[model samples]
Target: MKKRVLDVGNCGPDHSSIKRFLAKHFDCEVLQADGADDALAALRGGHIDLVLVNRKLDMDYSDGVEVIRQIKAAADVAHAPTMLITNYDEHHEAAMKIGALRGFGKLDLAKPATVEQLQPILGSAD
Candidate 1:
């Protein structure tokens, strides 16, 4: 079965880009959640291999760190790995402190390193 990735809080364009990237490189399905509540609901409803949250939610401008905290705190979905999408070191560090794995910046989406980072979580396309 294909792995499922729940992408939270990214804008329309970013979501599209991430969906395409994951589909092409990881062979995974990308699910969308515009906010924490939707994200949590999706997690509870099904199995998600990974959760990717933007640094700042475009819909509400909420901190993605708080969303990551909630996911980690939730008993049902805590097992799923999480990654914060951001270019800022401080923000990435903050997400890691809250139990998120190392994630890549949008600017680095096409980088080989990004593919390497995701391979462990999502596996190779082939």
Candidate 2:
């Protein structure tokens, strides 16, 4: 079965770009959620192998950290590995404190280098 990655964000095309990129290279399905409620709902409804969170949410850009925390706290979905994606490099450290394996700043992700950077992290399902 293909692994599923839950992506929590609504940053317009950037969100779609990441989703498409992950689907193409990670050998996984990238599900999307625009806010905490939607994310939590998706989390409960599916078998997710990974969780990618944007540093800022559509509801409140600064809520991404808190959202990840909530995702980690949920008993049903907490086991999936999680990470934060933010333009601010600083959130990488913060994401770790909240239970993410690692974080990717949006700045780094925007570059073509992201494919190489994420290969090890996402670990191809193949």
Candidate 3:
């Protein structure tokens, strides 16, 4: 069966790029969530295996860190790997503290190097 991934980000160019990249590399289904609430709902619904959360989401309800915390607190997805994607360096430490598996700067993700960096993580998750 194909692996499943929840990609929480604004529906835009950046999110499209990341979703396309993952779809190309693995037999996976990508589900888009506009913000923290939607992401948490998706996780609780067992629709995804991992979560790729954008640092900035559409809603003002909460940020990615809080989303990660919610996921970690939930029994269903507590062990799910949460990866935070951002353009800022300052959020990295905070994301890790909230239970994110890793942080990928959008700058790095824009480069071809992103594939190399993501390979091992995706492979293991699969």
Candidate 4:
């Protein structure tokens, strides 16, 4: 069966770009959520194998770190791998501290050399 992925992002451009990339390479089902509640609901529904969460959401709510924590705290989904994406360089350390399986800043996503850096983490989620 194809692996499922939950992609939580408030920005349409970034969410669309990542969804396009993943869809091209993997049999990924993308679930776009605007906030923590939607993301959690998706996870509870049982189709998600991995998650790629944006570091910030609408109205400055639901950062990636909190999403990661919620996933880890959930008994059913704790084992799922989470990749946190952010535009802020400083949040890199914070993301790592929160137990994200992988963390990539927007600068890395902008460059082709590092854009595919998420492949390994996504692959491992399978």
The candidate scoring highest on lDDT is 1
Residue pairs of candidate 4 with colliding backbone atoms: none
lDDT of 3 by residue, 1-126 (tens): 677888886557877777777777767888888876788788878757678888877555357777777778887777888888876767877888878776677667556566666665566322
| Top-down TM-score ranking | 1, 2, 3, 4
Model 3: CA > 4 A from native: 110-112, 124-126
Q: How many clashing residue pairs are found in candidate 3? A: 0
Model 2 C-alpha lDDT per residue in residues 1-126, reported as the tens digit of each score? 567888887577877787777777777777888877888898888777777888878656666888888888888878778888876767878878878877666566545566666666567522
Measured on C-alpha atoms, candidate 3 has an lDDT of 0.74
Off by over 4 Å in 2: 110-113
lDDT ranking of the models: 1, 2, 3, 4
- Alpha carbon lDDT at 4, candidate 1: 95
Overall lDDT per candidate, in order of appearance:
0.92, 0.76, 0.74, 0.70
* Shift in Å, residue 111, candidate 1: 0.1
* Native-structure RMSD, model 2: 2.5
Winner on TM-score (3 vs 4): 3
Model 3 / residue 105 / CA error / Å? 2.4
Q: Can you give the lDDT of residue 17 in candidate 3?
A: 76
